[model samples]
Target: MKSMTSRAMRAIVTVSLGAISTAAFAQADYPTRPIKLIVPFTAGGGVDTVARIVGEELKGVLGQSIVVENLPGASGMRGAETAVRAEPDGYTLLLSSAGEAAVNPHLFKNIKYDPSRDLAPISLVVKVPNVLVVNAASGMNSLDDLIAFTKSNADKASFSSSGVGNPQHLAGELLNRMASVKLTHVPYRGAAQQVTDVLGNNVTATFASYLAVASFVEAGQVKALAVTSSERIPSLPSVPAMAEHPQLKGYDVTNWFGLFAPAGTPGPVVDKLNKAVVQVLSNPVTAKKLADLGSYPSPKQPEEFKSFLATESEKFKNIITTADIKAQ
Candidate 1:
């Protein structure tokens, strides 16, 4: 019996050593092939664009090709679920926005993965502020005018968002709740479509990323009312923030994009990815490009990003619960 027990312990030790050796070898030869950065939205949107730009820089930094794969559906859940289930070898990553990484868990009834536990945050890439814009034909020029109009025509006025349970949608809901108004919601397939519908006057207003509607606003196709940031954006200084409005006492909503790997990724691999991202975001040329698109680099440490995500999750959970937003 003692001999059998000794043999069993020896077998276990050999297996453990083999596993450790395999993991170390895998980590050492990490990125033996191309890495996939899964963008949870379709191509030609802000998230896709950001992924391409950052992927280019990452390639140069990491000496490995970064392939961006667009898998759009279920308001980004399909792609997120894919990444969450991927192996934790640092090769597969999710390039997701605040809606997917922070907001969706709170709104959806049966999310297959939890961002807080199923994934590891590598770094925060950019912070994009959404603006409230109206079609030029609407004649709603300033924040005051729009507020008054919505207040008077609460039942008639409607606002469009990228989708239900999106950050933009939640922003509009926050405004409606705070201002004591009943502005109707119109959900679109994506930000591009939302911008189109707003510019076509199909909806009274839209909460959209500035990148999606900046050209339209500049071309006089749409009128910018207020940004959803705490301060005015440099590119659109004339537009006030919702927080500045007396009716919106503490309104603040901004969209963020970050890189994340599957949970259980080794610390060394996570650090490697985070360092590469920080270098890419810290470059002046990359920063300029992101800023040109109305986004700013937010290169946070991995742990810091993890903590921020936790807080944001709690915040959106409360907002969703209070607003009684149901998933579609």
Candidate 2:
């Protein structure tokens, strides 16, 4: 009886090994069909823009079509949940921003998926700085003027964010904490609406992704005061870094976009996807296109991105905890 039991266990082990080998082989030839890249934001937002840019370039390298599906809602939770529920076959990739992977998990109490547990970090695509902008006619030319205005007209001074718990919202909170101002946060459904309100002067200001606000600033529709980065971006060379101000001495917030797949995806498949992403990002045309949109290619290996996500997760957690941030 003991001999029979041992034989059964050995047979099970052999079958398991065979299955693992087969799956690895399958992953080696990944994306037999069109891969779906999910963007967890509305169309024309920074996330969607990055998805389309990378998706188009990725197809050339991977030799498969990439379908960018926008599933914007729930402070980016709905799309994340959808991606998490997808099969771990490497075909369902998610283009997630800092808020979805780092900020929202801590801010939302009833979040359906934990990014660290439910998603596999594929690559860090780009890091775009958030800009502080106001309507060109707001007559608030500099960060100082805006601060003074907010301080004096506390009730009327408002800042718009794509939504609560978004990196833009946190940047606003950081500014409030660091500058000792009381600008109210007005969360909008998407950057489009927020930009519209800010451009119309219906909102006092907005801390939004540089990509979302770049055209407006270029067209003189909005005036950019400062960027939420330690250094000024090349695209907006004249804009000063928020950290340069005495009031916001240590302020630094950048909105980063990265790729993720559902957890448990085969390592071989993840490696292939990462390789393809690296190739696409290294292309000069792709880099130029990204730069034109106020974003620069910032790719990282799968393991590096995983580690970076862990670091960002902790960083945002500290920010959320210190700011007492909550989703509305």
Candidate 3:
């Protein structure tokens, strides 16, 4: 009986060590198989575009084929959850946006995975800020003027956004809180009508990407008030950042993209992935492509990206709670 028990214990230890050694050898080789890059959006969308472009470049760097798969649903949470549950073998990766990784858990009640816990951060791919624009007819020129208008004419001062829980909606709510003003939110199905209403003076203002309403802005049909980034962007250098105002200091928001793998993936695997991404993002042609879409390629290592995600999660939670943002 004693010999049998001792044999059982040794067998268990040997099996455990074998498994660990196998995993370690697998991690050392890394992408021995084709990698599945999941983009939680429809094809041709911004997130999908990022996935494809970056994946194409990463294939060369990693010497493996990258297959970009779209898994769009549940405002991107479905795909994020899928990636979170994937085997942590570095073969499955998620190209996530702010919506899925930062805001969805706070916005949706039934989120299956906690982004900070389930998704291991590799790098932040890009940052795209929205321009807060008002109808030229409204005569609200700067952030100060807009604040004053919303305070005095709260009923009339309103901002249109694509959806209820999107970044645009949160940006408006942030202004309401920090500036102590109430600009009524007008949610739309998409940004096209939102921009149209702003131009028609049916709505006072809307937060849109500069590229989305660049023609109107250039044509003087819409007035640019401020950008939602921490500092003014070079594309619209003359406009001030939202954080520049005394009342709304530290106000910054943007649609950012990042790369993540499932939690429990080996540290060495994550490090190798990050190195490939850093090299890929520096490609001149790839940088140019992202730049044309108003995206700045910004890469950070695992630790730094982990910190950014934490800060962003906290900030998003505050905005959603204070503004009572909900998903439908």
Candidate 4:
């Protein structure tokens, strides 16, 4: 009987040791297969471009292929939800825009995943400044002019956005709230269409990524009124920021992109991804490429990025409430 008891205890100990060994090996051999990086927006947009660049760099750094998948729908909810439900093996990750991670939670009534609980923030990839541009023929020149025009024609003036509850929409809503003006919102299928509409004078104005409409603004096809950043963008120094506008007191809204992994991914795996991201964002070439697109590389540590997202989520929640924005 004593011998049998001893054998049982030894077997239990061996099984525990084997389990520990397998877990350790799994952590060390993370990404032994290709990794999927899901972008919650359409291809050729700012978020998609950043994901491809970072994914390519990660492939080189991790010695594994990183595949970028664009699953654009429901203002980036579909792709984000897919990433949230993926196995927490560090093999499937998300590259979500600020709207998906920060704003959509407050705007949408039913979210399939919680940003804070279902996903782990890896790093902030970049922050893109959204510029307020109007068709040159529309005669909306400066921030003051736009505000006056909107106020004077509150019922008639309209603003275009990539979609309802997107960053562009939020920026416009925030502006209306702060400036005490009313502008009808015209939601488009995508940013490309929004830009085209603004350029064609079919819409009164639009707040979009400078990279998307910089050429049109520079060519005098569209007039840049103000940026949503706290400071002037390097690419468009002449245009002032929303904060610079007296009527837009304390207003600052910039779109951000970040990386996330499903919750329960090992800490070491998260660290590995964070390290690779920091290395990529810190590269001068990468910085320049992002800067050219009217954005700046963030490259924050995982904890800091997570904290930042929490704060941004709170901020957007307040904005959505104060602006009286409703889901459509």
Candidate 5:
């Protein structure tokens, strides 16, 4: 009986070693074929554009073609759910946005997958800050001025956002709480119409992604009051960050895109993907292109990216809960 028990234990050890060796070999030869990158938004959108750009760069690094697939719906949940359900192999990846990865889980009830549980964050591709803008002719030149104006014209003051649950929307809500002013939210389906309305003075102000509104800001159609970031972005050096003011001291809201693999993917495979992305982001040409879109291509390794997402998730959760934000 003792000899039989010892043999059983040895057999188990041998099987375990074999499995580990197979996993190691697989990781070493990852992307032996073309990889599919799932972008959970419509083609030509910010997330899709980023995925295609990164995919082009990654193709050269990995010596494998990256096929970008668009799966747009459910506030990005559809594609995300698809990615989560994919096999935990290195070939399938998700090009995720702050909405799908951090905000949507809290915004919508009965979300199919928990980002923290089902997705492994690889790297933060780019982060774009939202800016507070008023119609150029609105006569609101600073954050203080905007606050005072909103207070005086509480019934008339309004702000527009691309959508109800987007980061820009939350940023506006946060401002309302922090400054004790009531600027009613006016939700739009997309940035183009929202910016056009703001320019036409249909809304008193708007909180929008810097990239979405940068062209108008440059054209002098909208006056940027403050950016909702910790510091001033290099591209818009003249605009101050909201945190610079004492009343809005803790304000920081920015939209970011990240690369993710289904949870339980091999660690070495995740590392290889991270290394390839880090190299892509480090390229000057890529950085310049991202900058042109008012996005900063800042890549963080797997663990670092995971930590950053945690912080962002908490921040959004609080804002959504306190503001009583709900999915549309």
Candidate 6:
């Protein structure tokens, strides 16, 4: 009986070793087929566009076609859910914005997958800055003017954002917290409308995407008060950074995008993906294209990106908790 038990244990060890060898070999030759890149937003949207740009470059680097699939919905949760549940093979990946990867799970209740646990970070892809703009006709010329206006007219003051619990919304909330002013929050389904309402003076101001407000700002239709970054962006050199304010030096919120694979993916596979992403982002043409969209490439290795995500998650959670902000 002892001999039989010993033989059984040997057999089990042999089988486990065989499986390990097979998986390692597979990971070594990762992407034997086309890789699917999921974008949790509709085609032509910012996320999708960024995914395609990176995907196109990845095709050349990996020597395999990168297929982009849009699975937008549930506030960008659908694609995240699908990606998280996918096989831990390198074939499936997600190019996610800050909302899905860091904010949405906290903003919305009962997310099926925890981003920090269920996704393997590849690299940070891009960072986008929002320009807080008010209608040029509002007679509000600077951040100080806007703060004073909102403080004195709290009952009538309002600000618009792309949606609740996003960077734009939280930026406004951060301003309220540090400045001790109460600006009524107004959510918009579309950014264009956010600008439209601001232009119409239907809302006092908006934390608008640079793309949405660029032409308007150049056209002098909306006043670009300050950008939501630690320093001014090159595209809008004259505009000040939110943190430049003496009392609001801590103000900094940016919408970013990153690449991720399903959790439990092999380390070899993850490393290869991160390398490809970094290479793609470093190309001059790719940088120019992203720059044209008002975004800039900012690449980080898996561990670095993971750390950044953690910091961002905590910041979002603290704001949401303090403001009692929720999505219905």
Each candidate's number of clashing pairs is 0, 0, 0, 0, 0, 0
CA lDDT of each prediction against the hidden true structure? 0.89, 0.89, 0.90, 0.88, 0.91, 0.91
Q: Which order, best to worst by lDDT? A: 6, 5, 3, 2, 1, 4
- Candidate 1 — which residues are off by over 4 angstroms? 1-22, 25-29, 137-139
- Pairs with backbone N, CA or C atoms under 3 Å apart (clashes), candidate 4: none
What residue pairs are clashing in model 6?
none
TM-score of 1: 0.90
Per-residue CA lDDT of model 5 for 78-180, tens digit only, reads 9999999999998899999899999998999979999999999899999988888999898879999999998989999999998888898999999999999
C-alpha lDDT of candidate 2 relative to the true structure: 0.89
Q: Candidate 1 vs candidate 3: which has greater TM-score? A: 3
Stretches of candidate 5 off by over 4 Å are 1-16
**Per-residue lDDT tens digits of candidate 2, residues 21-136?**
98877877777899999998889877898899899888888899999999988878889999999999988999998988998889888999999999999999998888899999
Candidate 1 lDDT for residue 249: 65
- Encode model 1's per-residue lDDT on 75-116: one tens digit a residue: 899999999999898989999999898998888778899898
- TM-score of every candidate relative to the true structure: 0.90, 0.89, 0.92, 0.94, 0.95, 0.96
- TM-score between candidate 3 and the true structure: 0.92
Among all windows of 10 consecutive residues in model 5, the one with the lowest summed lDDT is 206-215
TM-score, ranked from best to worst: 6, 5, 4, 3, 1, 2
How many Å off is the CA of 232 in candidate 2?
A: 1.3
State candidate 5's TM-score. Answer: 0.95
TM-score of 2: 0.89
**How does candidate 5 score on lDDT?**
0.91
Worst 10 residues of 4 by lDDT: 161-170
Off by over 4 Å in 3: 1-18
